[model samples]
Target: MTGVEHEPANERYAYSRTALARLALSDELRELADRAAAGVPTTNDMWAQPGEVVGDALDLVHQAQEALVRAVIYERQKHTSWEAIGEQLNMKRQSAHEKYRDAVAEWQLALQEPHYPAPSGAPVRGLRLHEAAYAPTTAGARLDAWVHEHIPAQRETEHPVTGHLPALSTAEEMVQVLDALNHLYGDSRTPPDPKARARVIERKAALLDRIAVEQGRPEAAQQAEEARALAAQLHAEAAQAPD
Candidate 1:
């Protein structure tokens, strides 16, 4: 009889049962199997075609078995007995030893092959003991307090031109930018003078124009153009106002 004709009905049923059991076990596996079986005339026909889906699956299985064998061989060469390795792999001691005897010899030969010096590099500098003070811990808090105690308070100086403006040496331009952002976003908590708001808007327009020209962003260019137009409109309205 031919191979198909000689095949037992019980063996075929067992194969079908196992395939169904695997499909039930995982939705992902079932989906993957479905995708592989799609467009095919018959699932059984895939086994007959040497370079088909079944062949690809068998190749993967062979690769996994070979990797496992190599791992077992490496472990055995490290003075690990076959029985100990078998227990770790959940296999019989005799089976493990028989399967990997040649592989173990190959691994032993590979280990004997040469050692070379790696390229040298600069040694890394670890963080200093005092630098640990920045960490978010009780020790860090105590260190910060200790440092603050040792530091002296900064003395304030009077400005020559405007005593009204504080001698804090703060970046006033940044403050103006922040004011403009707040005004544009309608954050009215910190109310600014009308004249100061107009000046800020003009300065912000100039800054945006400069940034737009340098960066080449269409959105920024559009914003800069709009700001300049608003500033010009505000200036014209201010000029037309009665003194």
Candidate 2:
């Protein structure tokens, strides 16, 4: 909720695919911890609120299910086939597709538009079902905070949760965007839209330019230049793409 409250207007379009996957894993882990805490049996003769406990446990189950859907979306983004997904779920391909088709389609739509019409006909941003739940900036911070509180050992040990993940920064965000674009548009069976790729490359170039100016780093400036050149090349190729 704090993430939603504090999201900047300009920076609230789409989350990188990596963020979605990480958020899904974190959410599932958090719910599992909650369920474990709730399942602790009453050892002493204390006044146990059985109804409240049961309700909390049920809620955790529902939350875990939602997290599973997020995980499925991440898999789908990687071009994983429905048959593979169904095999893992111990069900038929059609059954798995029918179950998750809406969620996957909604995710694809949100990635492109990232906004929906509000009741008053105003376009609302970053409050969609997926964005509100897993905005990259805040989601990463929230997970780090939760880990420190619930899994302090992660901070101390060489655990992937903390060890493998780099600190959240503008450069890190750009890198994630590039990585997601690679998975979506790079060497895939489906023909990617060159214009769309060019547009993203142009944006990356602009961001890198901004970073170079603000950071005054030679490497950043070089990256910015390279990105601009690549973007120009992409635009030229896109011009040659079939209409």
Candidate 3:
């Protein structure tokens, strides 16, 4: 797993396809199948296992997602209306367009013709992997944060607020910020990025300030303000000093 880079693992999404598949549903998986056939309750321990139902359900969700991607491809190729897509997806036209706008654009730009040498079923995933790895644009990150927050709404689990990424950031800065994030979360053994120091300080100070205000922690708020001022000073100094 050391060499593998993938999505952030959350309750809603699995880390990787391989990892998910490797997770055996349960020894009772076959028994659960039998119980279902007999129209009996499957949750009983005799025919069930803890977490297995949810795990199997999530796997089906992953499968559904693959199919959904292909469907989007076909629909976009056919020049389907966003309203129709939205209705099918149980969302508004704007919501449907917003959700898949980037994807639609990417596919449209990539393919010169509809056929394009007989596209494979899962070609979109490869493009996605490249986008994730070298996401020089904030669009990817914004969409990612949005998806993460929105998907878990039904579960009532709050996600972290990823404040807007600086639009003025260069590709190099984006890379640095991404490296820092990956180091902090994606892997335990990796060290943080030196280039992300200023942004890291600023972002942490901003988050702390938000938390303090929300929790009515006056002392914490004061500390966060002081930290933000310090970060600003460092940023100014670095800007002036030049690299």
Candidate 4:
């Protein structure tokens, strides 16, 4: 005959008893009880009627877990003592040490893998909707080449006509570049200043003249002359305005 030994019921209830004692007088416990009474169910089973909610909750949990794992690995990698790590994480030092020992070793080994460069001219992957809409691809051997051709060269640093104008300070250059960029990209809604607008028109007229000379187009030359005449009329009007 085999004899069976029964465990004490008090021993089995020890954890619950300790928990109740610890929480008996706490405001947190009172708040939790109040919330429970208000029919705000805390369990996943209670919210399972809404499939989307369940899925979203699961996604959040997964993201939170990944962040926690990454943080743990980072802390360990940075040579923080287990006791200090436990204090930060609000856990027992021994428990923290045990929980991450295997993960630390695994991550350390993973860090040893040699990093390889991405293939040249590889298509950009995983851009979000807004980013994809704003940044389009251009055919070039490299990103630098693409930028050089597609992005306007920093507004020919010196003005086309009067190399006499003071070199734009960094801030002024930034403002000018940003203004041009906003115009090109449809980011600006306000009308530009009248005086500045006149200057731009004059510069454009000069550029048109140069282009007409290069292309040997009689129509382009006529257009350039018309532009110059318009510019002179605008300048005369501005000069006559009361200061």
The runs of at least 3 residues in candidate 1 whose Cα sits more than 4 Å from the true structure, single-residue gaps closed, are 1-51, 113-243
- Each model's lDDT comes to 0.44, 0.65, 0.46, 0.44
lDDT of 4 by residue, 1-243 (tens): 011122122121112211212221122223333444444455755556668565655655665554465566656644668999899889999999898787666543322211222347644332211111112121111233423343477244332212221232333333433444344334366654445445545555655566678767677678768867876776877788778
Question: Who wins the lDDT comparison?
Answer: 2
How well does candidate 1 score on lDDT at residue 62? 62
Task: Write candidate 3's Cα lDDT for 1-243 as tens digits.
Answer: 112223232111111211111111211232244344443345555666787777766665665564465455446544679899999999999998898788666544332111223246634332322222122223234443544644575234232222322222233333433444554454467643333456556655665675677678788677778867877776776677646
Task: Give the better candidate number (2 or 4) by lDDT.
Answer: 2
Model 4 TM-score, all chains together: 0.28
The full ranking of all candidates by lDDT, starting with the best, is: 2, 3, 1, 4
Task: Please identify model 2 stretches exceeding 4 Å from their true place.
Answer: 1-15, 35-53, 121-126, 129-134, 157-243
Task: Single out the weakest 10-residue window by summed lDDT for candidate 3.
Answer: 18-27
The residue-by-residue lDDT of candidate 1 on 1-243, one tens digit each, is: 011211122121112211212222222222344444453556566456666766666655665564466456445534578999889878899987877787665433322211122236523322211111112133223333433443334113222112221221124333536644564446467554444456557666666666667667668667767877776777777777688
What's the lDDT of the predicted structure labeled candidate 3? 0.46
